[model samples]
Target: MRYIAIDVGSTFLKAGQLDVQNLAITHMESIRMPEPLPNENPLRKEWNAIQLLELMKGLIDRQLASCPGCKGIWITTQMHGFIITDEYGVADTPYISWQDERGLEYADKLGTSYFSALMDRVGEKAWRRTGLWEKPGVAAVGLFHMLQQADLGLEIKRERQGKACAASMNDIQTLDSKRLCTLGGYLIQSLTGSHVCHITNAAPTGLVDVRAGKWDKDIVSAVGCQALQFPRIVVGIDSVGHYHSRWGGVPVYPDIGDHQASVLGSLADAKNEAIVNMGTAGWISRVSDAYRIGEWELRPYFEGRYLPTITKLPGGRNMAVLVRFIADVGQSIYGITLTEDTLWERLLAEADSFSQKFLAGERQAGKGQLHVHVGFYGGQTGTDSGAIDCINGDNLQVGGLFAAAMEEIAAIYERNLYVLATAGEAIRRITFSGGVMMKNAFLRDAIAKAVGIEAVMAPERDEVFLGLLRLALVSEGLYASVEETREVLLQKLHANNKGA
Candidate 1:
């Protein structure tokens, strides 16, 4: 059977048809996700929840029309964010992007009291219960929603061209009886008319009892959110309902998060392997059999598995921002427009020379003099901040900046491994995926070197879709679980290769 897999990503909504028997993508299409409102706060990245849901439906329709044999539908989406829905299943608030930073500002303002008291009481309890920390980005909206209900004068402010704009807080009070779901949950509700979310998305929200796959009532009580406001939790194999599409009604499964789905899609060894997905925001994940909370997040993966993930900043997009800055600076300084390729080549050459010099002990990487700290979310914190930290772009040429960023990313990989090792999980191998390393072999080599392991490139570029396809198959009773489906598909692929 064939299945339609939709990935509701941060920047794009990707849909594809997967041939289950052959384990290949037959067709694929990508649609750009709607941009944040210009009038919204410059720091805030958000989208109209209802509008995006409609666009997703349109894309699903296109996929169904193109793939005549589509039998099932499965979806994956960006993990973090809050989508508030009223009793009529209409969105009551804009979807808050995980990149939004207003929560950090709130945390900073609350200072000692926030971390010591509120975070310890509310956040820690939730973390212990759900295996999810109150990460500034992940749980910010949920916390804000709760705080606003208390009438604590907490305001969500937006600025448009320096003019102050305010998001309506009137919706906060009414949410007591309303429903709140993630982007995936809301979209699934629109598609299958099911007010439910899968464990992959639910566990990371600091709102669910991850081990039990249900909302933690204690947390809801502590956070002052109504237990009924949250959507019911379901696993990947659970079929919520049927989506009435161009191909008629198909069994639709609960939507999962893109990160976990990517891990599944990459076909990483659940026991002994790690996955590094490099993109606009990069992350390293290692799957474990059971819940094990630690400094890093223990996220719920498919089939009751847990993933301990360490996030990385300075991903491809961050590197691109620095590259653009260097190009712009070079053009203004010398009346010569330097292309990204040219700059990258020059930077690589210089970085190689720098590496040789360090090996020979002829020079040392300066400490405290320059440190390019990528943001918490792996995207660019500022245009020139990353480049500026590595070199003085005005006075010193852009030689080691790119190298510094690459090294920092590798260091982050190593650091995360160290944390896992400290937690008593020793990973044996790593499988890497992402568009950034599709061309840049140097960065891949650097990561391999830093992690002290050979970074294996995932064979499938459409691993995310493959993961969703597995979910669809499992839902259809073709496989017992995602892991079993992956193993059986691998066996088929191996046998086919042998025959060929």
Candidate 2:
């Protein structure tokens, strides 16, 4: 059997064909996602919902054309972010991106931010029920901000009509018919005409009760959006509807979270293994049988499992800051131009060489080492910043700079891993995935050494596509469980390698 797999990623829209019998992915391709729509407020990031949907449809159509007799469609998407829709599932507002930060804007004369005011209104217990911290860009916070704006608009309208406007926070007629959904849920609704969300995709919105696997009524009421409709929550292996096209009607499964899918594709043992993924952003995640409230964020996983994750770690984007700096210096100071790829190649070579020597104690004590922090983009707390210190004439070279950055990232992972351990997650093995980890052996090795455990790479480079393939196998009843499916697939892959 064959299936079409798609990932609506933050950075790219990726698609491919998954051959179930052989467990291979073919015709894999990706296109950069459309840039966010221009905004007057620098912190507000958004996209044209209809335009993004059209682009996704075009990509899916292209893949469907290439793979004849495709049995079904499986999707995974970047978690969080939401779009407001009408009853017919048509977008009513721009897609608010997970990167949007309007919630961080000050909301009162005393200078409390929208996010802070939201937390105060919801209370700590209600917020903790969602298994998330008080942060901006979550769907719940966005919904609150929307309601406030509507109230303000309504008050102005009443004033213009020369009527007394009473505070009717719950009586906004404009929001009466509105619904909320993540980008993935919206895509499913657009394709299959069914308004449903998988638990994995919905859990990150800071609205769902992770332990109960449903929306928390208290949080909804606290946000003053009890009237707003949210998609019905679906669990494991359920089809939303069938997508009709020139080929035929294909079964479309509810979209899953990309983070969970990537970890699933890595084939890590949920009982004893943890995964570290580095893409545009980075996270370290480990699955738990029961939900636990702690420093880590808890997200829903397949089959009643939960993932305790440390997210927003420095990642590829942070490294690009340094690379772009070098590129700018070359162009501006020396009239030389270098592609990012070329610069990365040279930097990696230098960093790798220096790392080997440093690990072997070849450098004099503190002679060629620098302290580097690559948090150019903020961290989980949203206040962290990047820095490079201990810079001297001997350690200010490119090799030293990159080596320090890699070490610092590894150190950050190590610190987070300790936190996970303290919280009682016994992670015996580590599986590394994502573009940065897969391409950079130096970084992978640094992470392994820092964590004091040898790590292994994920079986496939495209973990998200591979994850969709695994989901198809289980959903089609080929395997009773994820563990069993992984075991069989790896066995076949090993046999194939032996024959080759």
Candidate 3:
């Protein structure tokens, strides 16, 4: 069987056809992700959900032109972002960026003292009931009200042990009867005409009961969202709808979060591996079968496990900033527009020389320093503050500044890894992915040195799309389950990579 995989990302949209039997991508193409308004303040970070849906349809149609035998279509999208839909499943507003800062204001108004007190009262219970910690950034709570806000009505129901529990009413009335949906849910509705949420995408919303795999009514009430405001939950491999394409009917599987999909597509042994994907944003995720939640935020993964991850908001964006800074400085001083690639090459050369000198004990620490820090979304330690402190001289060149930034990024990754390690999580190896490490060998080695682990590149260049392929195989009955698909794919990759 063959499948078409769509990966809707913040900066790029990728679609491809994969031959399941041979584990080969028949054809793949990527384009810049469409944004509605490039200059608008809040909307700048957002994409038009309807426009994206149409773009996806076009991409799939184009791919079908070459590979008409595709069996299914699976989607994996950027997480923590969402779109608003109407009662009839029509998009009501533009898709909102998860990086929006509205939630910060809301949290600040609540204050640390007040918020901490509230967390002390309901945090543990919320975690137990909803599988989410009470944090502003963990869930896209910062952008939750972009759709609608209303109080929820609850009904009493009995569990298996005949214990009374608060059940959400089926009919949740919003201020205008509109509802919230993730990018995946909205796309699913547009493609298959069904309103549903994949467990992987739902977990990041901070509204899902991670254990029960459903929306927690108490958490919904806390968000002022009625029951129906959240989409119906579906597992990763379930067939959500059938997309009718020109080739034929392709079974569409529920969309999974990009992080979860990357793990499924990249990790050979997820249980003992950590994944670090540095794209527009960066994250370090470690998977475990047990439902463990500690300092790091726990997200639901395929195969009924959990992913404890630390997200870096200004991930690869930091590198972009450095590239521009280097270009500007070079053009003003030397009258040349240097590309990022050139800057990176020079930076690596400078770093190599600096390392040699430092090893020879000839260079001092305080002088000629390039301090680069990328600020965090929330007040996360080691990343909450950013600065590039250096003197205006030969030392303030591209190589030193870029090397310092990479070191800071690696330092942050090391800290996140320590948090997971100290919590008793065993990490055997770290899998690296995303655009930041695409052709940069120096950054990869730097991250390995900082984390004190061998950082191996993911088998597939595009892990999210491969993850969608895994779901497509399961949805079309080519594979019995997600676990089976994962094992088989791993075996195929091992066999293929033996010669390399």
Q: Candidate 2 lDDT, tens digit per residue, 1-500?
A: 78998899888899999998888898988999988876678888878788888888888899999888888889888888898777777776677878888788776642687788888888988787787767787888877776776655532111112222343434444666867888888898989988888888887888888788889988888787787888999887768899999999988999899998998898887777889999988888888887688898887788777888888888888899999898898999999997777889999999887766663563556364687877797544322778899877666778878988998888888888878765455778899999889988888988898888859999888898888888888888888877777887778778877999
Residue 225 error for model 1, in Å?
1.8
Q: What is the lDDT of residue 196 in candidate 1?
A: 89
RMSD of 3: 7.8
Residue-pair clashes per candidate, as listed? 1, 0, 1
Lowest summed lDDT across 10 adjacent residues in model 1 is found at 378-387
- Pairs of colliding residues, candidate 3: 347-399
Error of 3 at 289 (Å): 1.1
Pick by lDDT: 2 or 3, better one: 2
Clashes of 3: 1
Instruction: Between candidates 1 and 3, name the one with more favorable lDDT.
Output: 1
In TM-score terms, candidate 2 sits at: 0.93
**How high a TM-score does candidate 1 get?**
0.84
Per-residue alpha-carbon lDDT of model 3 for 1-500, expressed as tens digits? 67778888888888888787776776889988864534334413545566777788788788878876767777788776666666776655556556543443333334443234334444576755545445544343633333222222333121212223333333234434766788878877877787888888887776777888887777666555553456778865767788776667777778788888887777556667778788877777777778776777778887777877776534767677766776787899999986777776776787766655542342444455556776733454457776777544554555566667777778877887788774444787888887776766677887788778667998788887777777666766787777788777877888888967
Please name the candidate that would achieve the greatest lDDT relative to the true structure.
2
TM-score against truth, every candidate? 0.84, 0.93, 0.83
